[model samples]
Target: MRILFSSLVHTGHFFPLLPLAAALRDNGHELLFATGSDNHDTITSLGMTPIEAGIGLDVGAPTAAEQLGVDPDPKAERSPEELVRLIVTAFADVLPRRFVADLEPVLAERAPDLVVWEAGNLGAMIAAKRAGIPSIAHGFGRVGDDDFDVQGAEVIQRTAAEFGVELPGGRGFGDRYLDIYPESLQGKRFLAEEADLRIPLRPVPFSKPGPLPAVAEGERTRPLVYLTMGTAFGSAEVLRTAVAGLSELDVDVLVSAGPSVDAGELTGLGDRVTVESWVPQDQLLPRVDLVVHHGGAGTTLGSLGAGVPQLFLPQGADQFIHAGVVTEAGGGEQLLGEAFGADAVAETARRLLDEPGYRQVAGRIAGEIAEMPSPAEVATRVVKPG
Candidate 1:
């Protein structure tokens, strides 16, 4: 099958989808990935065919920050409803017009067998519908909201609706994000069995299995701390805070700041801290003692799958809810009440390290994550739909 993949144009979002794309290609399917031009390099780097779409915000654009409504100051909190309103207006209102306008020609030209859309991309699914092709909503994280009525296709449909484009089906008529557009079937069968989608719980991105880094083997001698704030939210201050928290501990700290944060700003980092642009969390999780993160769905669940103790310091988005899920599941602790600082972070890190309940709960969550289908497995089923 020829697949058209559309998603949010950020490295973190695209990175997870790479494994699935590779799997489809290996299985003899043709894949074309579409996102903002900003992510072109990342798309090509992953060895996927790239379709350029002018539908993303510039990561370095000052206006982009204003558009996102993220206050750089950690102390200032946007009311949850206000934040929701901001995000809803941004993606559901502002983004669709631009996205749909750009996607029309691409849809007409590609005419793919199926559109594999990131649940957060807004209007590509609508374009797929416009092209009269079967489309699948692929979520890289938890699916929230019931609008547009299709399961998990929040970004796509909402963006389309904003542009006054009617979808082929009614609302509540397709798969939810987690289910990958199950509601849209109307009895149409899928290549991957629906039952298989349910078996592993959720899709996880991973590279082909390989040996761990040489340093990783010996690094396990002490408690291993995997510290990251995800690809989007990393900052010098956050890195400094993470480094400070782990400074006094006997643990080996691994920090991934993505390409966003400055390396020079991490000057005072402790000797045990290893900072990098990226690391293989799936590969490193088993050897780590605890995972401290900004509560992005990808990292939160990634850590959970490893069954490692988690300390979530959510800064935005659905992270708050994901943190709540982890806390409710008894998997780890939620660091609340303040923007993180070295002292507070250190204390939280200590709790995650020393608390027996935290470890036990994390172990259970890991078991749950492990049971989810790998991303490749999910894609195999989705592509080969019966």
Candidate 2:
């Protein structure tokens, strides 16, 4: 069977799905990605073909708000409810609409038998439905308390109606759901919780392959902490503040600034810290004593898979939710609001290192993740050979 994988343009959304794609490829199925034009090389680098599709959320977000006639003054603050409504409108409506348009052509040209979409790429399934193909929704991490499936279903139904497209009327996205989260961290509600076809595939953390970014290049010394804001969030100030806190400890801090941030601009932090635009996270997590990062699903599950404790400085998206879950699960700690600072980070890192409970829980979660079906084992279930 031929499969077309879909995700939001960003690496955080795009990377998690790659392991599964690679797994399917290893099973002798052809696979490709439909995402932003900029991600073409990123996909091709991993030896997969890329077909550009849809705009980024940054472009689709404001447009969704504008369509809703909820334009806000730049100077004004947005209420929590309004912010969520806007997000729902974008992912469930505007972005999906655009994605359907872009994917219609690709679907016709590619004629893929299966469409596997990450949680963020809601429209790909709709496109697949329109093309009379099967589709599956794949999750990246622990789902929050939000009822995205039920609420988003309403918006998706309306979007489908606008296009005069009739869906199979299962869940909002698709009937089949690929659940990558470890069963322990699944929290209260799971994505596609009610779907009969929901299946668990272990969260395999993936990043661009690279050498370890440690500049000192030594066998073993003091503890090493891998620091990052992930691909979508964080700033120079955050990096510097985190590094300052990590500095207080007798640990080495290596920061993966992500592609958006220039490592050269982050000079003068002295020799205690090493900054790289990116690092091989799959390789780095186990080497680190602890992880300090924005709670991205890739990094969160990656750390858990490595049995490494973490200090989450959540910036946005599911980071806050992830922080709460990890803290509750005893696998890590979260820093937010007034509590986020150099002192707080230093103090938290101390607790994470000095305390063994965090590592123990992380190890348990790692064991759970390891026991879950591997991507290769699950790939055959996603799309069977014709």
Candidate 3:
């Protein structure tokens, strides 16, 4: 079967879909990833074929910002409701029109058997329906409390009219919904009524395989903590602050500053602290006793998979919701706004290290993750539908 996997241009949006793509490919199914041209190299690096099929909206552009009505302040805090409204109204609703235009030609050429898309890529869903192919919605992390259908109704209606297809019902498009996080971390609303269509799969973390710094080589007498701001929000200031905070602890620290932030820009680090431009979380999480990071879906699920406690300093978007879920599950802590300072980070790190309950809950979640269906198993089900 020929399957088309679609996502937005960002790595965070695309990375979560790789494990299933690998599974399908390993089973001899043909696959092509469709996204913006910006992500072509990232897809190719993972040994998957990428077809460019979306517009790269410049969020920094005055026109774009005006269209979205978003505040330019990067540090401004938004409640989950406000964030979801902004995402749906400004970004999500507008992107699908361009995605539909970009994807139409690809759909005509490939004639795929199915379309597997990230949850937010509504254009893919529209294209799949138009092409008369089944589609599946793959989630990056825990589905939040927001009602996506209600939030995205206007966009859905407009896209449907443009594509000459009927709008999806209240449940939205997709024959199946693939949720990567364990049931415990999922929003209670999603689990309560929509569990029938939601399939649970273990969140397998993947990155562009590359040579990493030799942090795992020697024996360590103290606990190891890995700090990162992820790919999108990484800044030199965040790295310096993390280093300063964690340096006060007894544990050894490794900070990944991402590609945008230069490691040399960070200074005043003690002998126990190591800073790198990029370190794959999948590779480093095993050796980490605790993780301090922006509450990205990848990091949240990856830390749980590794059985490591986490400290989430969420910036915006679904990150705040993810942090809340992690805290509720007893696998981590969420520090927001003023609480997300150097002193608070260090104090939380100390408490998490001194406490064993966090690790125990993380272990339980890890065990649950291990028992969920593997990508290979899900792939078989995808091919031979029940």
Per-candidate local distance difference test: 0.64, 0.82, 0.79
Query: For residues 14-129, could you state the per-residue lDDT of candidate 3 as single tens digits?
Result: 88999999999888888899988877887787667889887543442223345667664545566666555656654445677777788888999888888898877778888888
Off by over 4 Å in 3: 56-64, 68-84, 147-149, 170-174
Candidates arranged by TM-score, highest first: 2, 3, 1
Give the best candidate by TM-score. Answer: 2
The residue-by-residue lDDT of candidate 1 on 215-283, one tens digit each, is 577635788888888777777786787788788788888887766786656665767887766776678
* Per-model TM-score versus the true fold: 0.80, 0.93, 0.92
The residue pairs that clash in candidate 3, if any, are none
lDDT (C-alpha) at residue 353 in model 3: 86
Query: How many residue pairs collide in each prediction?
Result: 21, 0, 0
Question: Which lDDT value does model 2 have at 214?
Answer: 49
- Weakest 10 consecutive residues, lDDT, candidate 3? 56-65
As a TM-score, model 2 comes out at 0.93
